[model samples]
Target: MIEVRGLTKTFGPTKAVDDLTFTVKPGIVTGFLGPNGAGKSTTMRMILGLDRPTSGTALIDGQAYHDLKQPLRTVGALLDAKWVHPNRSAKAHLQWMAASNGIPSSRVDEVLRLVGLTEVAGKKAGGFSLGMSQRLGLAGALLGDPKVLLFDEPVNGLDPEGIVWIRKFMQRLAAEGRTVLVSSHLLSEMALTAEHLVVIGRGRLISDTTVKEFVDRSSESTVRVRSPQLDALRSVLTSHGLTVREDGHAASAAAALVVLDSTTDAIGQIAGSNGIVLHELASQQGSLEDAFMKLTGDDVQYHAAGVEEVMGGAL
Candidate 1:
């Protein structure tokens, strides 16, 4: 298990990570999420002792990472695969890392097999594709058979199959009762991968909860409908006590109507009773990404401009 307590880092006047506190438990995958420049990399560096924190501490099973008796066996991380030299074969890379940590050469081969990189072990890491590099990085992380792992955006450049394999590999490691903390941008992918989530924005903690609980707390469901006579359909739907709003681009032009707080079944009731010709109707429950956006709204680095909606009538 790993615990970060009030971890903070400042570079000049900018605080990269601040007051970050979270516990990553064994037997589950904890996801770390933040926008670009949101202190994620800073926190990871602090964990590995690559960067000195301005205050607070990160611990691996109650001790700092550098103080561990067998640091490599205690924690494995893939922070930047790009750090590997271009001329070194994947096997040679692992050999050097293993030697640094006193890990045996046989263990390197074991991890290469663990990450399915044994066949390409002789290939230079620089010549490998992005997906292959990701795999090689993963192999290096597993080389020491660490009980704790930190994977920062482990799926950044992988193909679909590689992404799937990485997801399964993380789960398998957690099932063996290892503590695994991973970061990723694909909400759907994270949804399937993480059991717990620690979300951050602007160097502040946004949420820390179970994946399902966090997502549920941040999003809501709405109903979408498209029809030629949108105004009439909007009137009828809004009159039935459901909230209705006219979609701007979809309104007037495509004639689309958005009915808020309308369930899939209730939407059916609205259509049947009002005789509203529905070209499209789907319950639009927000996704994990939407939840992330809502939870981090104030800290979003990029955002679209505010949108306006035409109104048939306010609910």
Candidate 2:
């Protein structure tokens, strides 16, 4: 397991990470999430001992990273796929890593084949495409067959098939009782990949929970009601003290009404009692993207102006 307790880091006048604490348990994939400039990279670097923490601790199985004997055999990480030497062959890269950690040289071939890089194992790292480089990086991380793994954007340049493969690979590793922590900007992929989430914002912990709990707690569920008596339905809903709004996604002359914080049963009953003709009524569950944006809206460091803003209200 990975445990971070009150972990903090600062650079000059800026505090990159602040009192961040979380635990990643074995047999599950934990996602590390934060907006850009939210100190996720800094925290990961601190955990790996690449950067000294300003205060507090990041421990892998109760020991600091530097104190581990043959750290790679215990904790494997692929923070950057391009960390390898451009001139070195993929085989050479894993061989050197294996050698430094007292890992058997033959294990390099095993990992290469595991990551499907056996055919190009002899090629220069610089010549490989982004997807191939990512595979090579994954291979290096698996050279020791470590019990703990950390990956940052592992599917960054992968195609659809490669992405699915990586997702399943991580899941399989976790099933074998390894502690896996992945950081990625793709919320959709994270939703499918990570079983748990450790979310941070503005250098502070925002949420640490299962994906379902996070979405359920942070996002509002709504019921979409489509009806020919849209106006009557909206009035009835409002009169009943429910928040109603137009469903912008509806394309019909009678726009669909989205009833916030409501259920289909309640909406259907209301429409029925009011003699409103309903066409459709469906409950919409809050998605991961919805929850993420709602929770991290303020913590985002850079905000892109909307079209109206860009046009100075002209639109």
The model with the greatest lDDT is 2
Give the lDDT of residue 265 in candidate 1.
81
Assess the local accuracy of residue 243 in candidate 2 as a C-alpha lDDT between 0 and 100: 97
How close to the true structure is residue 264 of candidate 2, measured as C-alpha lDDT? 93
lDDT per residue as tens, model 1, 99-194: 998999999889888888899899888898877888888988888899999999999889899889999999999999999999888889999999
lDDT of 1 at 136: 87
Question: What would you estimate as the lDDT of candidate 2?
Answer: 0.94
| Alpha carbon deviation, residue 73, candidate 2 (Å) | 0.6
lDDT values for all models? 0.87, 0.94
Candidate with maximal TM-score: 2
Candidate 2 lDDT over residue span 1-315, tens digit each:
999999999899989999999999999999999999999999999999999999999999999999999999999999999998999999999989999999999999999989999999999999989999999999988989999999988998999999999999999999999999999999999999999999999899999999999999999899998988888888889999999998998886758988998889988888888788988899999999899999999999999999999999998
Residue 87, candidate 2: how far off, in angstroms? Answer: 0.9
lDDT of 1 at 46: 96
Q: How far is each candidate from the true structure, as Cα RMSD in Å?
A: 5.5, 1.3
